[model samples]
Target: MDSTEVAKQENIQRMTSNENTAIVIDNENDAKFLMKATEMQLEKISLGKLAQQKGNSAEVKAFGKMMEDEHNASLTEIRTLAQSKSISIPTTVSEDSKDHYDDLNEETDNDFGKSYSKMMVDQHEDAIDLYEDAIEDTEDPKIKAWATKKLATLRTHLERAKQFKDKNDNLNS
Candidate 1:
C-alpha cells in the first residue's frame, strides 16, 4: 500500500480499537452500578425490618415499614434490569452496611428508635448521592432511567428520616 493509504488504515484501526474499549468500559460501569445498588437496597431492607421489630416509636415503626416495602420494590426492579443486562448482583449486603446493621442490632430499646432513625437518615442520604452519581456516570439508557426513577423515592425517604430524627430529638430534649 502507498504511505497515505497506510496512514488511513492505521487511523481506522485505532478508531475501531477505541470504540471497543469504550464499550467495555461502559459495560464494566453498568455492572458496578448494579452491584452497588443491589447491595444498598438489601441493607436498607435489613435495617428497615429491624426497625419495624425493635422501634419504640410508632412513627419510627411506620417509617421502617415504608422503607422495607419500597426498598423491596426497588430491588425487584433493579434485579430485573440486571438480569436483562446479564450482570450478576451480589446476594449479600456490603460489609460496611453489615457493620451498621450489627451496631443497630446491639442498641437498647430506649435508644433503638433514635439510633435507627438517625441511621435511616444517613443511609437515605448516601443512597441519594449514590443514585445521583450513577445517573451521571452511566451511559446505559436503562440504568440512567432506573437511577432517575429511584432518586425521587430516595429523596422522600431522606425527608421522612430527617423528620423522624428531629421529632425523636425533640422528645428526648
Candidate 2:
C-alpha cells in the first residue's frame, strides 16, 4: 500500500520471473540512486538550456545543445528504469542546482562562457563520481548496468567540459 510495499512487490515479481532465486538488495538504495541521478540530469538539462540561450561562444552554444539533447535522452531512460522498478525520482532540479544556475545567469557576456564551461567541468566531474559510486554500490543488475552504461558518456562529457574550460581560459589569458 505504501512505496516500500510497492517496491517489495515489484522486486518479488521481477525475481519470480528470473527463477525464484531470491535477490536481496536494498530497494531504498536503488530508489535513492535513481533520485540522485534524476536530480543531476535535471540540473544538467536546465543549465544546458541556459547555455544555449546565453552562451557567448558558438562552441559553448553547441555544447549546451549537446548537453540538453543527450541529458534529455538519458533522463527518459532513467525514468523508464525507475518506473520498471517502481522507484520514484524527483521531477525537478534541486535547490543547489537552481542557485548555481541563478548565479551563472547573472554573469556578464565576457565571463558567461568561461563561467558556464567551468561549471560544466565541475558538474560533470561530480556526475562521473556519482555514477561510479552507483556502479560500485548498486546490487541490482539493471541499476548497475545503467550506471555502467552512463559512466562512459559522463566521462566523455567531462572531457568536453574540460576542453571548453581550457579554451575559455586561453581566451582570457
Candidate 3:
C-alpha cells in the first residue's frame, strides 16, 4: 500500500483505540438499552422481510428488499461492533415485533401490502428517532458517529416510504 493508505489505516486504528473507545453505557441497564436499540435495528430488517413478501409495486418491493439486504448487513456489522465491547444483543425477536407481526400477518395480500407500507413508514420513523437519540446519548464516539450517519439514511428511507405509500394510494384510488 501507498504511504497515504498506510497513514489512513493508522489513523483509523488510532481512533478506534483512542477517543472512540469511551463507552457511555456502563451499567447493566445501559447494556439492556443498547441491546434494545440493536434489536430495533434488527426489527426493521424483519419488517422489511414482511414488506418484501407483501408489496405489490416493483418499487416498494425493491425498496423492501434493499432494506432487508442493507440492514441485515448492518446488523452483522453492528453485532460485531457491540460484541467487541461485550454487548450481548437479545437472542429473540422483540415483543413489539411479535405483536406487529401478528397484526400484519393475517391480512390478505392486498391488505398486507397496505399494512406493510404503513409498517415501513412507522419502522423508519422509529429507526430515525432511535439513531438521533443515540447520537445525543451515546458516549462511545464511534457508535455515536455511526448512529448519526444511519439516522440520515433512515430519514431518507422514511421519505421514500411515504412517497411510495402516496403513489400506491393514488393508484388504488
Candidate 4:
C-alpha cells in the first residue's frame, strides 16, 4: 500500500482504539458510545429494509419504514458528529448483526411480522439503555446533549414497538 494509505489506516486504528490523543473526543467511553450507536443504527437500517420487503403485515411494514427513515436521519447526525470529532464510524453493520438478520430472515412469512415486532421491541429496549448510559457517562457536552436529545425519541420508538408487539402477538394468537 501507498504511504498515504498506510498513514490513514494507522490513524483510523488509533482513533478506533482510543489511543489518539489529538482527537476531539478524548474519552474512551465517549468513543465507545459513538461506535456502538453507529452499529445499532446500521443494524436497524438493514433490518428495516428487510421488514419493508418481507413483512406480512401492514403494521410491520410501516414500523420498518419508520425505522429506515428515523435511523437514516439519526445516522446522518452521528456521522456529522463523528466527523467533527475525528472519529471513524463503521459504514456497515457488524457480522453479528448480519447473522441476526439472516436468522430473522429464515422465519416464515406468517411468523415474520411477529418475530420482527419482538426484535424491534428488544432492540429498542437495548438502545434505550445504551442512550441512557451514554447520557449519564459521557463527559463531552456535545455527546451528552446528543444522547439526551435522542433519549425521548428512543423511548417513543420503544413504546411503539411494544404496542406493535402486543398487537402482533394478539393477532398471531
Candidate 5:
C-alpha cells in the first residue's frame, strides 16, 4: 500500500498500545525528540535548498538560503547532543516534513516566499505545542529540559517567520 495507508495503520497501532502513551518529553525523551526534530530540520533545510535554487526573487532566494544554513546548523547541534546520550537518529527525512513542503514546491517568486514564511510560522507553532505539552506532562528530566529549550526556540522562530511574512507583504504591496 501507499505511505498514507502505512501511516494510518501506524497511527492506529500507536493509539492502541497497551502501555501508557507518552510523548518524547522531559530530559530522557530529549534524545528521542532531538533525533526526531533533527530529521525534520534536515528536511526543512532540503526544502530551503530547493527554494534557493529556483526562487523568483532576491528575498525569496535569500530566505531559502538562510533557512538552509540555520536549519542545518540546528540539526548539527541537536545531533551532537543526541550523540552524547548514545542515541541513534534516523538517516531518512520524515514523511510529514516531506509532505508539508512537497505541496509548496509548485509556488514561485513572491507567492513562494509568502507561502514559505507562513509555513515556517505554522511549523514553529506546532513545534512549540509539542515541546510545551511534553515538557509539562512528562516525568523524564532529560525530555523536560530539552523540550523547554526547544519550545523557546520554536517561539522565537515563529515570531521571526511572522515578521518575515509581514515584510514580504509590505514590499509586495
Candidate 6:
C-alpha cells in the first residue's frame, strides 16, 4: 500500500484498540466497585449483628442496629445495580473482615463496647473514602448517582461513630 494508505490504516487500528481498552477498563472498574461495596456491606452487617448481641452499652447496641439496617439497605441497592450490570457478587465476607470479626469476638463484654465503637469509627471512615472515590471514578451515571447518595449516609455514619468514640473516651477518663 502507499504511505498515506498505510498511515491511515495504522490510525484506524489505534482508534479501535483504544475503544476496546476503554470498554475493558470500564468493566473492570464496575466489577471492582461492586465487589468492594458488597464486601463492606457484608462486614458491616456481620459486625453490627455481633455488637447488637454482645455490646455492653445501650449506645453501642443502637449504633450497631443502625449499621446493620443501613448497610443492609445499601447492600440491596448495590446488588440490584450489579444484577443490572451482569456482575456477580460474592456471598461470603472477605478473609480480612473475618479476621476482624474473630478479634472482636474474642474481646470481653466490658471491653467489647469500646473495641466495637472504635472499629465502627475506623471502618466508617474507610467506607466514606471508598464511596467518595467511587463517585469520582465511576463512568456509569447510575453508579455515580448511587455513590453520591451513599456518600452522605456514610459521612453521617462516620460522624455518629466518632461521637460514640468520644463519649467512650470521656467515660473512661
Give a tens-digit lDDT track for model 4, residues 34-140: 78888889899999999999988787889999999999999999989877876666777777788989998998676888888899999999999999999887778
lDDT of 5 by residue, 128-170 (tens): 7767777766676665676677677677778878888887666
Please give, for residues 44-158, the per-residue lDDT of candidate 6 as tens digits: 9999999999888888789889999999999999889977876566566777888999999988665887788899899888888888888888899998999899989888888
Per-residue lDDT, model 3, residue 5, is 35
Question: Candidate 6, after superposition: displacement of residue 113 in Å?
Answer: 1.2
> Who is ahead in lDDT, 2 or 5?
2
Better of 4 and 6 by TM-score: 4
Off by over 4 Å in 5: 1-32, 137-143, 169-173
Best by TM-score: 4
| Per-candidate TM-score against the hidden true structure | 0.84, 0.84, 0.75, 0.86, 0.69, 0.85
How do the residues 1-173 of candidate 3 rate in per-residue lDDT, one tens digit apiece?
Answer: 43223433443454455543443223233354456566766677777787777766677678778888877877776777666655555544667777887787776655666777777787778777777766776667767766776777778789988987666655542
> Against the unseen true structure, what C-alpha lDDT does each candidate score?
0.81, 0.83, 0.66, 0.83, 0.67, 0.80
> Total clashing residue pairs per candidate?
0, 0, 0, 0, 10, 0
- TM-score computed on alpha carbons, candidate 3: 0.75
Give the Cα error of residue 166 in candidate 3, in Å: 1.1
Please give the range of 10 consecutive residues that has the lowest summed lDDT in model 4: 1-10
List clashing residue pairs in candidate 6: none
- Residue lDDT tens for model 2, 1-173: 43334544665565455642433246656766787788888989999999999988889899999999999999999989999987666777777788999999998675988899899998889889888888888889999999999999999999999998898877762
- Candidate 6 regions exceeding 4 Å error are 1-19
- State in Å the error of residue 13, model 5: 16
